[model samples]
Target: MPHAEAVALSGHKILAVGTTSEIEALAGPSTRRIDGMGNTLLPGFVESHLHVFSGAYGRKLLQLAPITGRDALHKAVRQFSDANPDEGLLIGQGTPYGILEEDGPITRQKLDEMEPVRPLILMAFDFHTAWANTPALKAAGLFNGRDVGPGNEVVVDQEGLATGELREKNAYLPVLNLRTSGGREMLGMSGDEPETPPSAQERADDIAVLKEGLRYCAAQGITAVHNMDGNRYMMELLREIELEGEMACRVEVPYHFTEGKPLPILEEASRMSADFNSDMLKSGRVKIFVDGVLESGTAYMLDDYANAPGWKGDPIFDTEAFAKAAIEIDRRGLQISVHAIGDGAVRIVLDGYEAAQKANGARDSRHRIEHIEVYHPDDLPRFAELGVIASMQPQHPPGTLGLPLEPGISAIGRARWPYAYAWRDIVDTGTAYCFSSDWPIVAVEPLIGLQATQIRTPWADDMPDQRVSLHEALEGYTWRGAYASFMEDRTGRIRPGMLADLVLLGGDIEAVVPDAFPALGPVLTICDGKITFEA
Candidate 1:
């Protein structure tokens, strides 16, 4: 773990950590040498949070992140539609909330102007909201608002027609299913496997997408991924990929627990945990969504939003139900990871975790709260007290990593700016945490993430600086991330006997300015002692 000139890999574990001369003496003729070229090498990146299947499939969709203004939006949509003429549905990813110059709320009319005929749905960058054209809304039968359960809405106008603004997963899922892949990639978010089995061709297509995603991760120097959304079918697909000897990154999936699912569903989660308890692919965690995101005015906040004064957002689960489920999940010994973005949601989840501890005595649960974008200053210490891991995305903070500031900052209100994405505050409280990209929401590039964390600018002159040190950020994506996922012994650090999951950067990360970190990427990536990528 100390600073060494070189580290040697043998089979699937580190053979030696020493000076270059010392390690060279142990190398056999068959050993392949990798020249660092004055670049830095360290443990491979561990993506602490991401939706791999969705991120993979999203790559096939038209990206709207680069396109701007109404003219560009229409051009991009028209081009994408023309290219995929026969495709059942046209979907766009990374659609900005403020795509239009004058935006009240993005209506179906805006998307209709872009691509009127084909069912078009532009998903917001955060994946919490989406805009669907009239055809898409009709195709999904959401033209007339249907009850989409709690915390989800098919927003309708004064005339009772859908406004095209679909909030949260439940509302937009029907529209998503219109795609050819049957939206199996996101079925896991609702804690459901495909209603019926896929045909052989469909299965093959899904496998191919998974392969693409894994390869993409490998290229980014990600040796391990803690997938935030998935189901049994996804696990099976990953297992098949592993068997085919094509798995480029180690993956850990969770049993998604949605609102309507009964407590007995925890039994199914337990089964999943037992079934896929391997090093390559594992399932020993439960994922739950306590609220939606702030951008869409849906994140359950403690107080009214700055824009919408009367509205405080919605909670996905009833307080008692979530507490009970948390207790049961804890009792069953599954690690719990909840998606909670607002201060209100953060409090509820913290209370639920505390309830679980009271009911089922404490163990090293290492329970995680994904995306603590905003939290009450008083509840800050609970993360450490309850032993919760702050699973966060450095790219998510508004104004960092090219994210816009208005919508997210306004949602939190000016009064709470100090508590929003308070990375430094969380760390100072002695709470364990890790950083991630939350891929497809952003790109799955750790170096970009490192830069975002280090170069984060304060919202106001008086606000506390939230930037973390370069080494601390690196550990978040490596050692600390492994520790969060319970894979510390197997992967995190560069030491003798640790698994040879390593990344060699193109240039020394410390030598460059913070802004230049994004340009520095993996020259070589090795996972399980196999050269997964070499540039």
Candidate 2:
């Protein structure tokens, strides 16, 4: 258990972990042997946060990450439209903020110029904002701005016509509904079940899409995925896959308690917790969004933005409302995971957790704060004090992982630079934290994520170095992630009695440099004693 050179698996569980000779002694004649070929073998990576279902479907959409100017955009749109002639709505994913250099704001007219007739929608990299063409807006009934709820906006012009800039999920849900899949991809984020249940054939298609996503995760050496968004419909699909014995990864779904939903809706979360409690497909967690992302200025900051005067940001729930909901969820014995990006939102989520502890009395809730991108120094220690987990994505930091620095850095301001995506500070405080990709928002590659943490540098020389050691980085993606998801006792370590979830890297992780990590991938991935991926 201290440091083993070999591990033996038998029937979906580790039989022994010891020196090569000791492990070999335990093997029988019928045992299948695998040679690592000097590659490093580790517990399979646990993705702590991601939207698996939608990310799978997003693979088919046109990617705008590589495009820079109008000419390129026009060509890409035209080509995509031509390629998918039967598709009703043309959707583009990973469109960066300020993609159009000459833009005031991304207006419907500008998008119309790119694709005049076919309806088109471009999703921002953060997934917090979207821009639709005039046709798309008209088709979705956003031509005349409709009141999208609190903490969401549909940008409109002086004459009260939609401008195609939609701020949050509610603002864009209508346009997304025009997709060929009927917006089923976003139903988890919207915290709604399908209004009309899918037919038998439709169910089969949905299952296939999820199967592809699971296969993708397996290929990435991901044995466990903590989906940040979900409803019963998604869980049902996963359950079906599990029953069919085709599930490749361990999936943990959460019930998303979106804004405007009644507090009693948490009962559904309890129901899910009871219905699917298997290790492969389980749900006993509730997810909520306290605020949006920093890039869009929807992040609830503690103080006014450096650029925008008197404007901090909007919060999905106030302190009282959030605390009340937290108490009830905690009392029901369910873990809570809230999306809190800005310092203000982080503080609110922390306050709500503390309130839950005070009201329900403390238990091993293992409640988590997702995306603590910006943290207030004053509230840093609460993570350890309240036994909360900091579920973070290393790829989300600006200046690394293809993310632009301006909007996020300027949004947080100079005074708060020391705390923005401050991984080192949080780790030093002895707080429990885990790493993830927040996939589709960022690529779901654990090695890339580990490289980001190892190679990350501060925005300025005056700021503290936020880079973490390789061991810490690995811990964040493996055991720490397993602990965060309540699977530490089952998997996360290549030890005897643990689940047979392991990944054989293409090269020795200890000997490789950070720059070459992207080139190195999983040569073999095993889950539940089955070889899930082999390269």
Candidate 3:
């Protein structure tokens, strides 16, 4: 590729690419000029995986990013709760694992000491772990402890009382369910439709929330998104935006499937794919959670945790159950993405993909594994062999972002240190890869994430080296992501006949230092040949 100068758009497609005058000559009447103003231009970013509705809603809640001290957390909660006394609950986002080291492991007594009367929950940055106050637990019926499925747990004290720490969704659903308005939005669920239909004002408000999220993504140079959480409600919301001609990005929504559901339920997924197929809104994929995360020690590991002997984390699905689900989805010809965060989970998903191939005869299934935080060496090559896409997030912050390595790295055991977050190792294996922010868990800005992937300094001389070049990192966020979703032909690149989804930065990207990427902004954003944003 050469250093290009200009591009001309015809309706929703790129018409020509060349020098400024060469492009201008191809432009016809009624075509508006969008000046670059001496800024860099690139294909608008493809946000690979994120929860759209929840990320937008988190902006209105208590944020605790970059806070570690016990006293700091206490003060933040008090200040937020005091200012918003009318709020139904006090929920905060972005608490890192390091906080446990500073304040000791969080417990019911610890949370009660901070504020016993009010219901409060501090969700971990991973969204896999939560610390609920006594009120929140009691309200959810976990006060005396409830037996949940394989991977879910309600941490309890030695005396058999419930601790404040809640592992996975079922552990803390009660606290999250209390929100009357915009509550379902936070959970990224649309299953429970209201018995009473929403008024026009409420519908408008819901649309506003969706628009706000899409606009935010555009400002960050994102013109396409594979929203990880999905349901008919989410699809309809995006459909409404497309109907109104307000959509500024292409979306690939999925039908989230839970374990133990009958195979017949897949009929709805097929119908969804047929009914909602469009350039703007589409759904034909299925999302599954095969395991939890490493932060809470629930990430389903192949070996026992260094901190806990004879206890490897459990998978949400056992071998036979997952194999059955994979065969059904594969037989339906739908793409699937599994949330496998540990080596054990990763191996099972790989095996399931392999079994699906053996049963149905091989095809370009392109199944995916989200958050390969750690993996076993034997399973590394299977990704390329099985044609699985490794979807990862760069702003995860713990691996090379200077956060304390306690609990996580140590818990994984020194023997498995090399296997944790090995980006270079995975990329070297010829496996397909894509990057995302997983916003509502981390910052959605790609440049900020680029800093960690392209310029992260290892925590120690002995830690594994996993540095990726800036060009490769950008590709992970753009063309590669498009390829993963089968949209490479229409939107990933700036070429003739492709959708005019492009972004203009304020300066030459190649000349800027990787660390300074956070300072860069998308000065102009054009999506589907429409000017959606200008700085």
lDDT values for all models: 0.90, 0.90, 0.82
TM-score of 3: 0.95
457: Cα error in model 2, Å: 1.4
Estimate TM-scores for all models.
Answer: 0.98, 0.98, 0.95
Task: Supply every candidate's count of residue pairs whose N, Cα or C atoms clash at under 3 angstroms.
Answer: 0, 0, 0
Query: What is candidate 3's CA lDDT for residue 460?
Result: 62
lDDT at 146, model 3: 79
Per-residue lDDT tens digits for candidate 1, residues 51-116, read 888898888789998877888888888998899978888989998888775655678898888888
Flag regions of model 1 displaced more than 4 Å.
181-187
- Per-residue alpha-carbon lDDT of candidate 2 for residues 415-469, written as tens digits (9 for 90 to 100): 9999988888898889899999999898999999988988888888899998888
Model 2: clashing residue pairs? none
User: Which parts of model 2 are misplaced by more than 4 Å?
Assistant: 102-104, 181-183
